[model samples]
Every structure is written in structure tokens, then in C-alpha cells.
Target: MSEKRKLAFSKANYLIMIAGIIVLAIGFIIMTLDSEPYGFGFLGLTLGPIVVMLGFAIEFVAIFYKPKSKSDTE
Candidate 1:
């Protein structure tokens, strides 16, 4: 008898990963929008990097996230 194969990540996890990627994109965009001649402004030097790091953190969470199963609640 053959059994169905399961995917590595759940739908929620994939959604979270997508969100993370979007956040990363937003951070990069913010950096590019900085008015400083060489991107030395606050957005380029601080906020943008912080947002990008947050995005990476979100991705890390998504990669390790596991939904609770009915059996696990017992």
C-alpha cells in the first residue's frame, strides 16, 4: 500500500515566509529612498537595517514553526 507524502512546511508557514520576504523588500526600498548622498541617513543606516533584520527573524520563525496537532494536545 502506498501512503500520501506530506510537505515539509504547512500553509501558514509559507504565508509567514512570504510576509518575511515582503518585509525584506520594504526595508531595501526604504534604504534606497534615503536622501543622503551615500546612504548615510537615518533610514539607510539604521531603520532600514533594523527592518531587514526583523524580516530575517520572521523567516527564521517561519522555518521552525509547527502547528499543534490534535494528538499533541492530549
Candidate 2:
């Protein structure tokens, strides 16, 4: 039988995705920790959103990033 084609993401991609998810979760947590009324504190109003955007950027990069194979490096 012919070998099945592998999926796009390699191990590094998976790792990056997991890290992105963790970052995203931390962003949510940071937002929740805000003390100002209606979550208007720094963590919520600024830092949290920035972190979330960073996480999303990471995820997007991970999805598009392709590792070089030995043959490709030649």
C-alpha cells in the first residue's frame, strides 16, 4: 500500500499552536483580573487585548509556517 500523505503542520507547528492557545487563555485570565469598574483597568483595557492579538498572530504564523526538509535545504 502507498504511504499516506502527512498533514501540513509538523511537530514544531503543533508546539507553536499549543503555546498560542496558552497565551490566548492567559490573555482572558488577565482580562478577568482587572479591578477597575467594568474591566477598564490596564490589564483589561490594554494589556489583555494586546496579548490576545499577539496570540492570534502566533496562531496565524504557525498555520502558515512550513519546515524545511533535508531535500529542500540542498
Candidate 3:
């Protein structure tokens, strides 16, 4: 008899999730780089939010992405 096995997500999925988290961290760091008072400079006011949103988008994609099975590809 063979034992049945399954995983919630693949290694690739976790790698993507890690990348997204790294992106999010970079976005926050970019915001902190702003020299303006209260972080009102272009990085904080515009680039930061955009980057954060992109990070979130990446996270969303990573969470939903499904890798094709070896059999499927064949």
C-alpha cells in the first residue's frame, strides 16, 4: 500500500512569499530615507506607498498562485 501525502503550498510559493515580505520591508525603509519633515518628501509621499502597494500585490499573487503539477505539464 502507498501512503497518501499532500502539502498546503509548495517551496516556490514560500519563496515568493519571502520575496514579498522583503519588498514590504524595503518599502518601509524607503519611507524612512525621506529627509523631509514628517517624511513628506517624494519617497514618503509617493514612492513609498506605491512600493508598499506593489508589495501587497506581490503577496496576494504569491498566496493565490498555484504551481502546475508535473503530471499536468506532461
lDDT of 3 by residue, 1-74 (tens): 59868678888899999999999999999999999999999999999989999999999999999999889987
- Best candidate (score: lDDT): 1
TM-scores of the models, in the order given:
0.92, 0.91, 0.88
The per-prediction CA RMSD against the true structure, in angstroms, equals 1.1, 1.1, 1.8
Count of residue pairs whose backbone atoms collide, per candidate = 0, 0, 0
The model with the greater lDDT, 1 or 3, is 1
lDDT of 2: 0.93
> How well is each residue in 1-74 modelled by candidate 2, as lDDT tens digits?
69998876899999999999999999999999999999999999999999999999999988988888899978
The reply for model 2, stretches above 4 Å from the true place, is 2-4
User: Candidate 1's residue-wise lDDT over 9-38, tens digit each?
Assistant: 999899999999999999999999999989
Leading candidate by TM-score:
1
What residue runs in model 3 are displaced by over 4 Å at the alpha carbon?
1-5
Order the candidate numbers by TM-score, best to worst: 1, 2, 3
**Ten consecutive residues with minimal summed lDDT in candidate 2?**
1-10
| Poorest lDDT segment (10 consecutive residues) of candidate 3 | 1-10
Candidate 2 clashes: the total is: 0
Tell me which of candidates 1 and 3 scores higher on TM-score.
Answer: 1
